[model samples]
Target chain A: MQDPFELSPSECEALLRAGVVGRIALATPTGPHIVPVNYSVVEESIVVLTSPYSLLGTHGRDSMLAFEIDQFDYEYHRGWSVVARGRAEVVTDPAEVERIRKTWPPRPWASGIRTLCLRIRWSELSGRRLGTGWQPMEDLPVHRVV
Target chain B: MQDPFELSPSECEALLRAGVVGRIALATPTGPHIVPVNYSVVEESIVVLTSPYSLLGTHGRDSMLAFEIDQFDYEYHRGWSVVARGRAEVVTDPAEVERIRKTWPPRPWASGIRTLCLRIRWSELSGRRLGTGWQPMEDLPVHRVV
Candidate 1:
């Protein structure tokens, strides 16, 4: 694939490690709505916590899931999107959670216990970005601009 | 209402008229997701082009919808959020859309007629903003950041 956003594996890991904030994507009966989540980065996977009543907990966990984390520099017109696609499930055992908690601590948002951590386990993790050195907008024809 | 960042009716009209890109939120089967959509202000509402299979069309149109447009200066921490809360419906009549097309042209992203323009009837519109003061992170506790 002649993809422009060719980022190195280490670079991908760095962006994933940058922070725990990301947008959780899923479908609901009424429609799709997005919410910010404070996440924990664990062994090549992104984990999020939610309660049973949470929409995601209701529709997603144990179902197909994807987690996206990115950073954008507007002045430079460059950004990268890294998504992990896999299954989501509820973590019920406290001992298992305690074992994972030492390394990946669960953080809370203003939202609500509806927080169930989703683990996206996939190896096809990669990213794309808009590089520099584009011609100025002034050089384009009126029709081209359109 | 001691609202700090309220825009006048005309200002709100202009914001929608300016054709600033708006964020579209849709509920997906996996979870809720958000993406950028180019739109124009029409007849006191915000409109965007979407496909029939698009999440919004499948689960959102004619259902409760929420559209948000924001102008934020991250460096300055002074910005505004305009939220449109209402139901969305697909425009079926050609004449009503023809009236809309005169001002708001449709620029479809993907190639397909399955994608139609959705008019977000936002009768309950409201806005709020952050002040231009440098409130140190230290001054406010973690729970107050929200």
Candidate 2:
């Protein structure tokens, strides 16, 4: 893809809605940490539920973080991904909780937890799609101009 | 919480053995690509079974790549990960295959056709454990300082 690094806003939105699994990258005291998490694509941000006693729960609020969603169809050898860099914080308002609850029903993944509402502050969003092979940036097809 | 970077070798070994899933990062002609696969720990190296037509079958042999395994336990806010980086290649010997197969099933994951045998040439192994709270590297206890 020519523009493999850049993704259309509409495409980015579609990718986010396609699934709830993504990799979350956060900065701990020592270094960077990444973990696969199930998240909801809300508005322009990605939301996840976890125990409130967790480190990411409190330190993540308004803190710089990144969420990545990508799918690689090995059979067809094609996939796209989106990376969202923003601040994160816990969602506490009752009305907001109601809104999120309406779409996300009680699931088995979270087991039985009530206080795991966390939202990522949306910032810059971007992504890319892989083309034929690992061609150089200048050699990709014309349609893939990033 | 200390040693956020996964500094302990034992922790690394445990993560590799305890978890049966991991993502393999490879350098394809297109660029860096990642795929989720099931693997078993063998002599400290991560071994995976793939199909002859799969990417691992094509590039896993003698190809330098990265193997990553990590787990996040949200309840205790504890998790550990181990990453092994080196060359990967196919093992064709029946005796070698039997040895590894005895330790682990021929097919490790829930999906995929298991005919390709891959052994990562583990050059360096390292790991870190995440504690409930974030702590600096210096605060972490040193064990078997590699």
Candidate 3:
């Protein structure tokens, strides 16, 4: 089997910044919930614009949340994944929210009044890459048999 | 702004069946965690193969979990997302596991010993689509000003 490799902190941060969409995980009284969102990286924090009544915006405030982004190449069997664990906070300060809007605006793909900006300052950032080592040769028994 | 639309249960199931990859959300002692995984739908349950010691394999068993899949088109601003919420169970029955393997095997993109098969029978399935309504005319004031 091939082995996966770990990515450095800087690499993780770069990937997070480059990502356009990600999944945010939140724990609620009902259960664990996950939803996709368009996001932007600003000042080393992940910012997402959402409706205050939405699932993410409602349960995410002051709660521990996880954000993840990944890309996979099916034919090449190569991929990279990044995960960020942090606490979700509402950007209440109008000045700060406006600054974020001007610099790196979070645009929701789904149309709605996304006036509330949620910021997640990750306490932990980690990433991994798949198919980085020891690809099975075509002539190998495993490949030939399969 | 364009309005988002809700998808029916049948539409949600069809989307889930068509998806090959999804994110699974789990609540742990540390926080809410989300990770991508290759999966297959069988008997109306989502199945995934993973290592017994991995975060998902270990904590996912008997836990309330959330599974999500989505697709987005940036140019047209169109997309659909589906979410499945349920409790995870380990597929320990040899015959059942073999049947699932034959029908739709879970192939992990990341290299690992993926011997354990877990199934999540979702109690709730929901979906939504974006950019399905009226589109603002490009020659309108909002477009011209921007």
DockQ of 2: 0.04
Best by TM-score: 3
> Per-residue lDDT tens digits of candidate 2, residues B1-146?
22244456665565556655566656444333455565676785778888788766775567776666654443444555566777777878999889987876433423446688888766766775556464223232221111
Ranking by DockQ: 3, 1, 2
Per-residue lDDT for B20-105 in model 3, tens only? 77899999889999878988888889999888898998788999999998765556666677999999999999999989977877
**Model 2 chain B weakest 10-residue run by lDDT:** B137-146
TM for candidate 1 is 0.54
DockQ of each: 0.15, 0.04, 0.36
Task: Highest lDDT: give the candidate number.
Answer: 3
True contacts kept of each: 0.21, 0.00, 0.79
TM-score, candidate 3, is 0.86
Docking class of predicted structure 1: incorrect
- Candidate 1, residues B21-88, lDDT tens digits: the string is 55565545544445455566677677778777866668667766656555433333344545565677
lDDT of 3 at B27: 90
Alpha-carbon lDDT of model 2: 0.59
